[model samples]
Target: MTGQLDVIREANLGIIALNRPEAINALNLEMIDGITRALEQWADDEEIRLVLFEGRGPRGFCSGGDVRAVRQAVLDGNAEEADTFFAAEYRMNGIIARYPKPLVALTHGIVMGGGIGIAGHCAFRFTTSEARFAMPEAAIGFTCDVGVNFILSKAPVHRALTFAMTGVPVGAADALALGLTDCAIDPARRDAVRAGIAAAAGAARIDAALGALMQAEMAPVGEAALCAAADRHAGLDWTDEAAIIGTAGLEPQLAQLALRSPTSLIAIAESHHAARRLSHIGAVLAADLRLARLLCRLPDFAEGVRAVLVDKDQKPAWRPNSLAGVDRSSIRAVVGAA
Candidate 1:
């Protein structure tokens, strides 16, 4: 329907394809608007029985939102644009979460940040061996939005916090193990699976169609080592953040925390903790919107985006600079800003 997005109706199935391959299909406000409009139009239509999501790119499904653009808007003193971007993006995430019909996401390659926001909420998520998932917002000086915290809340807290705070990319096996995705299908079979779903859409035979297709194409993924290790150390006192980070086995994760923005880390950790108690996606997204508004205006967001996106220097001068420099009052202010 738009240059950056492809929306089509085929055999009663509504399909959405993210088409910005140059940027790994990173979403802009226009793409978000297009997706939301399509979902809104299809929501009550008797002809549309299912919705399928896919991305057009060899590199990945979606890298994330186009935060570089948001950063530019902020630099131009148009913070309202940044706010509008997040709000519209979050609204689209909410729509995907509450869609009336069964929704399927065929995510492959790099699916991070907002990519997870959409795919992770779908009713049926299929991934390829090439799929890599992460929430790298903390690294970008942004708190995880798009209801990812809500998804991470269901996992073991230690692992969830590590993944959320560190921005570590995980493979499809780990994604399934962490409950980020539902199944792994052969990459070559993706089109067949889509065709099968499309053919079965109108007859209300989705379950049966997927069952047969999955039986034929499902690939076996090995157990995820990260998840296994997390389970092995699940007894560790996760609440004692310092002691856990200082633990010998978690040195790599601790190192990742050291590289990210201190303010973002504090906000991300607090948000992840808060999400555990959130019973629904709507509540978590509301909390996310509140944090996003405050966090984007802070200095770290600008610096982080500059270093990681604009300059590609990978060196960000965080406002607080280090975790020790961040105070409880600062954390409370962000978490309570909403």
Candidate 2:
């Protein structure tokens, strides 16, 4: 109703809540602008020492951007309007990445695409066992944006490629292992943890407060064992660090992704590969923006979105229909060294 955001001041902490829970708090342009403007204003306010970002929902923190709507904007002949959304989103994401004070993201349930870009940069990120994390854009003929490569760079490259190609969601344990989240908490104790953080003194005490509450529920055991069992079932060799997904017993996921746009998958994988050599977030985001802006005007993205979200057919007639037909140079051009 308000194109709203919930702001509360407690102690020296300023809390920002993503108020749209029904849509899994999926960010729209208005929400992005609202939150970004708020953070910029908060950055200058002396009384606010720390920020706790949250989503109001029983299911997950945020699913991602309302990009299906953005695609619709483009279809309605307003490509620049669509571009404005990404620009604002990327700006907001960058602000979060460089937030001056202690910043904590309370994440649970589904966090993917733009959700990862926002929370991934926070200094203190907490997720529960219920969290499901992924990039997941390639499935809709787009690559992950907002410098996802920066996070993926800190993760295992092969696993990142597999994630890009297959859109497979990972759990908190795996996200922790992949450098996607800082801590895992108990789902039922989320409110208590928020109360603890709110009562915490400035930046220094935030750690102690979160750590105290971080133990309200111990991390579940067997994350590694769970991954191992899945790997074994997939007939993947866990020991070979050099093994790629195509060789790592992920044949089923790969085949499933074959139903999507192959060009998008390759672009994502290539971006991850290129990002490995870059160390700075600014550089990574610049590259991501370049690639994302380019992908926006392309045909497959709209087609893929129509098939996956609008039509619910789960069948997209992707150009370069087969992986073999996907042009290597064109994919490279999308995320290429300029």
Candidate 3:
């Protein structure tokens, strides 16, 4: 089954599997709707106590949103449809963040963009040795949405800004260090951990097991370095900060991720610094939406997508080509109320 939203009841626990291995369990509109329905149905069910959500396949839990569709919609000039999709997606993200139950998200592999939307807000986010987390929207010439502002705000300053703008994939150690994963399990031991959850007497045992897993996977070196980098980048202006961190190799892993666009990275870094001052989620989303619309009007977005996803040409010719060309006024124009 390419897109299976399996809802199985094991004692008081509900297991929801994202079974789209073909696409690494990418979140399409249908998948989002399925998840929303499952959550709503299970929310009222007294019989179900906890929810364990996972994606099938060894390659990933959930890679991201089905952006090909969004890209196509934009190419066809159906901007309203793309906007509607993002609106619904953001609402779903908010719901997940505020969910009442003990929602456990088992993030085993590539978790990016929309994957973050599903797993980022869970009560317990579990990961494995292979787990790679990122936010690459800026690489595609889009701002981070899907309640990412909330996650960004909670993250260590420069660390959050760097990851969002660079679209870098953090390994298990870095992920734990960044507090993205509550527990880290060895890839081979993931099954054992799941079985342990199944056999646990109550939430207490599950929590204990998770705690043990996290402690076992902790990486002091990675944590300390990341924290130091965040401190170094804090309170500096975006351009100056990016210049400093980019030169210092604050995140060497970003070079290997290869999914982010240089143009998007610049845009993302700029957005984070600007959004950091905003007081509310509505303000951030509105600002992001304006930015997204402006990006569509610009040539960078389509060109970036084409170069990366269409032509498979690793090189993208950005319009501005330089950060200096992207003025504060242009950014402000996007954030300003119409």
lDDT of each: 0.82, 0.74, 0.68
Pairs in steric clash, model 1: none
Error of 1 at 304 (Å): 1.0
Q: Looking at model 2, which ten-residue stretch has the lowest summed lDDT? A: 236-245
Arrange candidates, best TM-score first: 1, 2, 3
lDDT of 1 by residue, 243-269 (tens): 556653465434566577777777877
Top lDDT hit: 1
Residue-wise lDDT of candidate 3 within 1-338, one digit each (tens)?
A: 12466767888788888888888887777777778877888889887767888888878998887777777888898977677677666767766777777778877889888887788788778777667887767666666766666567766767776566666677776666566667777777788767765554255566676566556653332343444555665764556535544644644533322344444555566666666777765666666677766666567777776776678786778767665566556766676522
Clashing pairs in 2: none
Top candidate when judged by TM-score against the true structure: 1
What is the Å distance of residue 248 in model 2 from its true position? 8.4
TM-score for candidate 1, residues paired by index: 0.92
TM-score of each: 0.92, 0.88, 0.83
Candidate 1 segments exceeding 4 Å error: 232-254, 330-338
Candidate 1 vs candidate 3: the lDDT winner is 1
Poorest 10 consecutive residues of model 1 by lDDT? 246-255
